[model samples]
Target chain A: MASGSARSCLEEAAALGSAPPVSYEESTMPPVDRSVVADLALFAGLGPAELDEVLREARSIRYPKDSAVFHQGAEADAFFVLLHGHLRVEKTTPQGQQIVVRYVSPGEIFGVAQALALKHYPATAVAAVDSIALCWPSAAWPRLTSKFPSLAANALQTVGSRLQDTQARVIEMSSEQVEQRVAHALLRLANQAGRKIETGVEIDFPISRQDVAEMTGTTLHTVSRILSAWEQRGLVEGGRQRIVLRDPHKLFALAEGRVPSERSGG
Target chain B: MASGSARSCLEEAAALGSAPPVSYEESTMPPVDRSVVADLALFAGLGPAELDEVLREARSIRYPKDSAVFHQGAEADAFFVLLHGHLRVEKTTPQGQQIVVRYVSPGEIFGVAQALALKHYPATAVAAVDSIALCWPSAAWPRLTSKFPSLAANALQTVGSRLQDTQARVIEMSSEQVEQRVAHALLRLANQAGRKIETGVEIDFPISRQDVAEMTGTTLHTVSRILSAWEQRGLVEGGRQRIVLRDPHKLFALAEGRVPSERSGG
Candidate 1:
């Protein structure tokens, strides 16, 4: 972990050993700044003192790039806020298939098993890049939210937003064919993490074709075949772990059924 | 509508027109009983006085069998709890295919647009049977939740539970074959609303092949064909909208991949 000021309240809590959930690697990390999460939707409506109180209960841990934060079926005893960087949340089905549930962006709260009334984490969370997270014991959820009504209100909004996203994905998967679903997934990704390039919006992150396949509920081979077809049509430029949409409108037309599917078959 | 006591506080609120969203049909209906919702999870932490306060804001309406309580794209200005009976919640895709999102039973909440931060209802909610719902204006959500933190806390659990349900469906839809997916869907429905028969458990409410198709993310033709095969194998009995699982364990084995799929060339 990066060096910081001094041993903070989190260290003191770890020494007390009241909760094993939030205690990560021992470090003399500086105390969290109230300003860090002040603007996040999770902390909205909180006063400065209230924010400070919540932050005091948090312990910071640095996750190296591509490291597993938690695994499926592990005891879900903590909740976290991404202080910086991205996380990939995936669920492995009993048949050993992996599905990308969602990617957590910075300022978002996740691993919230308490909200789900679940005793174990349903999916695995991994750091997509080197990341920092502020975590608190799941036991603190009820106490803090009870004392601060706004916390519960904010949590409701967060869970509600995620439910809506999941519903939308379900609808898309149920109603559309494979290529159209993939197109919709890509458009959504661009909307979420796009960077403006000279020609078109390029997805800024280094995301693999396997990630795309997982997101759209298809095999990697199918994704490769579709991307190749799109590349031939000059619709999207696909390289290793990179994708740039050269003609987003055309893809949208195909996805929305305004135009015929260009790929014959895989 | 059923007649009860004289016009009460809800009538007065409707007369004032402060919120038009919950101004249902005028009726001399008796006020809601505190005991009716006192044990409900939503009102779990509330005192009798607080429950009364929340109930006072609700306007009751009786929806006849097969009537719509609300439609997709309608202004989402109200939230509801089922006082009695069941509801079928569905969403139509851009391509006009309908998907059954869920079936809401008595004592459960629905149509809380405030929780989703949505301006309109995302799905159509129809009465699967003659139903009564007590609705509050969406404008009151923040106010009531602010005053009663447990309301927001309970709402979090509700939305989180739905998210997990949706996630489970997404995984099933992505990873499983049609017969297995349909089996899982039926097993879940039976678990939710089944009535014990001599040899099997029957889904108590009337449900159609189309509804099963919608729930399992398959075509109606596919569902019919699969059901016919199951009937022939003595696994289930289907007549009109009724279904009885003659050997639920066999279906469960198929769904969980404990046994090989029996349907061939459907």
Candidate 2:
């Protein structure tokens, strides 16, 4: 189903109608737009000249917070590299339970299904915040690969890392308790999306207790109770939609199958 | 951990300070020995010359039954496209239970972790039977992509389908009964690896009932009992080491959360 939209592109291409548009060098194309390529891991190490080349073939887009970049099962005609803000990858079960699969931050690439041989997206990706991204038509990957070997290597590394993360989630879901899952999820978010303050590491995103509950496969009541208990002991401090980790070591302990000491957050 | 092995390549590339390899048309390079462009759904319409250019850069290999093409935690340096025979992709739990995530057949690709961003294989892939496949060095994808736009489109479609399959499996594991899981697994295996014979369709691989038990998260005793019952009812015929599906429609009904007939296989 993810390929539904992309399929149209193929159908269009096959019927011998509208050929794909090709962009010329920077001098001929739109002004060198380094902002997009600068924030992408794939193009990180490239020189300005190389970045310009990549940008020549890419288009910049702005998405409002909560907008969908790609719906699960839609045709994927292009691959995206996040230039700003965050995106959430999610899937919904037949029972209608939404599982937040993972998050994509600035400098990361999404919609890699474009390079894998599938035409559809396996999950829906929504802008978690106001976002800017660079898009390369799926038609460009092969030409890009042949022209820039680093791009392919970068793509491989991206896919490999994602697979490891997914495998970790599967392992966690299969063996870890919901409490432990919550601890791990929070720790991960802090590591990836956390901002440091005088208090502790604060997750950059505006996640609620309910969001945490859903991520950990538990009810909101359980997450609230657990967080409240932790707050009473000073392990965390949460109020007005903010969470600060008071003790990362203790949280790590909980995530590693150990019993954590009481919270210190007040 | 999938990219752990590939890290060697990365380190080597870094040490050499050599530019990344790109392009599939270097006349100095060997002929296309392996290419997914032809078999891949996304690249279905490329001209013969484009296909040949891809083939020149590909390499083929054979894997014996029970051998692993890649191990979990290993570096993912290449993506594979299976040409013939069956392969089982699985993850091992801390408790040592083997979870057969999926089985792949000819024309399908695996080891795609190389493309996702992580460098490790999240699971192990073993040949369920003697198998032949083509391998594309992870380094080659970038150039291939830029040179042959359709390759990316094909890959994207493939990833989408795989994601859907994995999602379905995850849902079944969470909600389906063991019997239903077993039935579904059997049906899946039959579709991917079964061979039509005069009597019925036989699973192309040499899988034991115990293997099915593990795949279904059930006990061997349970699988044995169920198979015995199915045999008596003529829905299936179980031999010492093989099972033939006599009535796939009935099996499908069982897999769909329905009760099987008392007169089923033996």
Return the interface RMSD of model 2. 4.2
TM-score of each: 0.89, 0.68
Residues B157-184, model 1: lDDT tens digits: 8888888999999998888889999999
Q: What is the DockQ of each candidate?
A: 0.71, 0.19
Q: Give every prediction's interface RMSD.
A: 1.1, 4.2
Q: Please write out the lDDT profile of model 2 over residues A12-116, one tens digit for every residue.
A: 234323444533532355633685457567775678887777766666667777777888777878888888898877777655677677888888888877677
Where in model 1 is the C-alpha error above 4 Å? A1-30, A263-266, B1-30, B263-266
- After superposition on all C-alphas, the RMSD of every candidate to the true structure, in Å, is 5.4, 9.0
- Share of reference contacts found in each model: 0.82, 0.24
Q: How big is the RMSD of model 1?
A: 5.4
